[model samples]
Target chain A: MKNRYDIVVVGAGPGGSMAAKVAAMGGLDVLLVEKRQEIGSPIRCAEGVSKKGLKKFLPQIKKEWISCEVEGARIYSPDGTMVEMAEEMAGSEVGYVLERKIFDRDLATLSGDAGADVYAKTNVTDLVLKDGVVKGVKGKHLGRSFEVECNLVIGADGTESKIGRMGGIDTTLKPIDIESGVEYIMTDIEVNDLCNFYLGNDIAPGGYAWMFPKGDNMANIGLAVLGKYLIKKNVKRPIDYLNKFVKEHYKDGKIVSVVFGGIPVSRPIKTISNGIMLVGDAARFTDPITGGGILKAMESGIMAGETAIDAIEAEDFSENELKKYEDKWRPTIGMKNERNYLIKEFFINLSDEKLNDLARSINEVKIKEMSVTGLIAMLIEKNPKTLENLSEILLKYL
Target chain B: MIYVDRYKCGYCGTCVAVCPEAAIDLLETFIDINDNMCKACDICVKICPIGALVDEE
Candidate 1:
């Protein structure tokens, strides 16, 4: 560890690593820190990302990083009515299940090769704020404490984003907008090439269940319940929800690995502050509908990296200069997030009867492709009552 | 009182972010919840996916 650097990126996840890589490649001295001893171990994701989403950033998908390549998706309603769609129309976690342990580490290695000082087992305890402007970070590396000054601080910290809070950025998520989730890496069950999504308030209130195959006969089975749903009787921790899912579905399956996490299912929060920027889950950039952040994390990282260089060249690290980072993401990913949030809100509130009806209607069409516009038209023709309770966007058309 | 069941804990740090008081801290493999700052909100308890965080009996 150095005493100073041009920029300091907290967390070694994909977002931070990409930011550090881009900044270092641009000739800026960068420091990347990860609290964990290993770059990626204790996997937190369902490990699924759209094929096109990953392709936008990486040159090519490495074979080892992929566990499975799904061709489409299967969405089942409470009554078991199934609506199938090709991968092109699948939301976020459809196309591929990645080995994040390898993928996250490789990204950090790329940043290191680009001249960023990447350090694992490094923890950022606090931000060095000078008059409410983030000046640097104070933390420990291998049992040694140090304070390093920097012109810019990029917080790529995930769901539990203390870095953003320490830098005076509010990253609070309401119970309705936060999902408590768990997953089990199960084997000894027949798996298919398509990802499966199950919906019903009875199965997982305020959320949904999914099974993403990971090759062979293994699959990742998981479900998340929004915080708002937890307050209801008999619904406590997400483990209970996962247990219900396993009992009913994967009862004969073997549990090899158990994982727990919380996904922020909210629209984008403020991502930039004075001399500070947040990327990935820290910025609440995860897709509101799918709770997927891998693609958006990399997107924000690239923008943050470019914005950092722009600020450095202008000799201005003020919020005014850093605003470009958020501005860059707003029109692109931000709009989609807001729209998805509304759709998620509506979907979660729907009755099981409605979900089953919609599923049957969509399945009946037997379409080759699933497009939003086409689905809207089909829904209006087949199930007009369901559209009556839609949010602002659809109501305008009605 | 030990509120954290270490055996069940995965330490993903979800409790730390959702803490309204900012009372919880994730330290490597373990998570520390500062009692002084905690208000027994049970938010972390309900949200803990693995049932690692339990409400004090």
Candidate 2:
């Protein structure tokens, strides 16, 4: 006899955990499986989350998960031009650099508290299907293979989710759309309680370097380079570039931990099939412009959870029914991702010289408050001459 | 032997940096694999700064 669940969510990241939480809350029998022995252990992220976006989904911030409360961010040009602003002025600026271990555990606890069965070290190796409708999952844990049945399946695995691909959802991303990221947790550095962004070709070809403050003397320093750019330039690893930047920028710091990962910058794919729905990085739910997905993952997980309940009650686990989850989010959350893709294209094609000039122009503006969108627009408006150049570059690359 | 496309090398020196055999000479635009000194560890092939170098199978 096989074990059973109303919903089985693969990957116990923020998205999967949140989906389990919502489904279990709605009186559904939910099971969450994570491949890692511990959730959030091999920290692969920069751990930054905007307060505004976070508040839109989660009612309150849990105290234990916050590493530091940031006031705003400083944007720097290649030659070191700087533009500083207050968090209130930029809605997306004020954020918390999280302790993801605590954060991820809390989400799983939320699911378990809501009556979901959570399993770590259980790897979902394959999807079990009956006549083109997903019926369950085949996995291994503790050196034993098992099959677990579920009416609906939610795939929230990260960038390398094989579960989504097995369901035939066309989840493969182009190399140019995937960012190969490397980061270092460094100590003995003096940093203000604000995030710092460095932009220029010298640091990253199609992405930027970030210094996210964790404390007065420690920070997460990292860079994201498009994988295509890495291949194009024949670099050894993205972290090598990050290390050079640290030596030049924060000379006194010593790296304590190094992490490498990838961020998907593509718009959310059409990620639903019969009895299946994909959420989080598996669906490329990450914001293309900023590479932030924790909040988006949580939002989509909530939607997926509620939708899973409907599918289970209908007893008709069809493609059309599962697609409602995608439809509900496609217009709002999906649209934002599409817009951010355009912005990412505009930023990635800029040369180091152009970025420095753009930064200088931005610093000259007496703007008090701006959205990340608004700031980019202001740069274009102030330097009308660059718009044509930007358009040309965008046409060639995007 | 390792083959390199000269055009793609950005001289980021990653191959030189990661080479355990110290067989690569960091150049302005690329690295020169010293065959005499090269042990063919394949680290340079994996860590090529621009991914310009490939090992012949």
Top-scoring candidate (DockQ) = 1
TM-score of chain A of 2: 0.94
For all predicted structures, in order, the TM-scores are: 0.94, 0.84
lDDT of 2 by residue, A84-188 (tens): 756455344478899998999888988999999988888787789878878889988855899988768899977666666678776655656777777889999
lDDT of 2 at A53: 76
Query: Each candidate's DockQ score against the native complex?
Result: 0.73, 0.04
Error of 1 at A371 (Å): 6.9
| After superposition, candidate 2 runs with Cα above 4 Å error | A88-93, A388-398, B1-56
What would the DockQ be for model 2? 0.04
Please tell me which predicted candidate would have the highest TM-score against the true structure. 1
- Interface RMSD after interface superposition, each candidate: 1.2, 13.2
Task: Give the number of the best model, judged by lDDT.
Answer: 1
- Docking level for model 1: medium
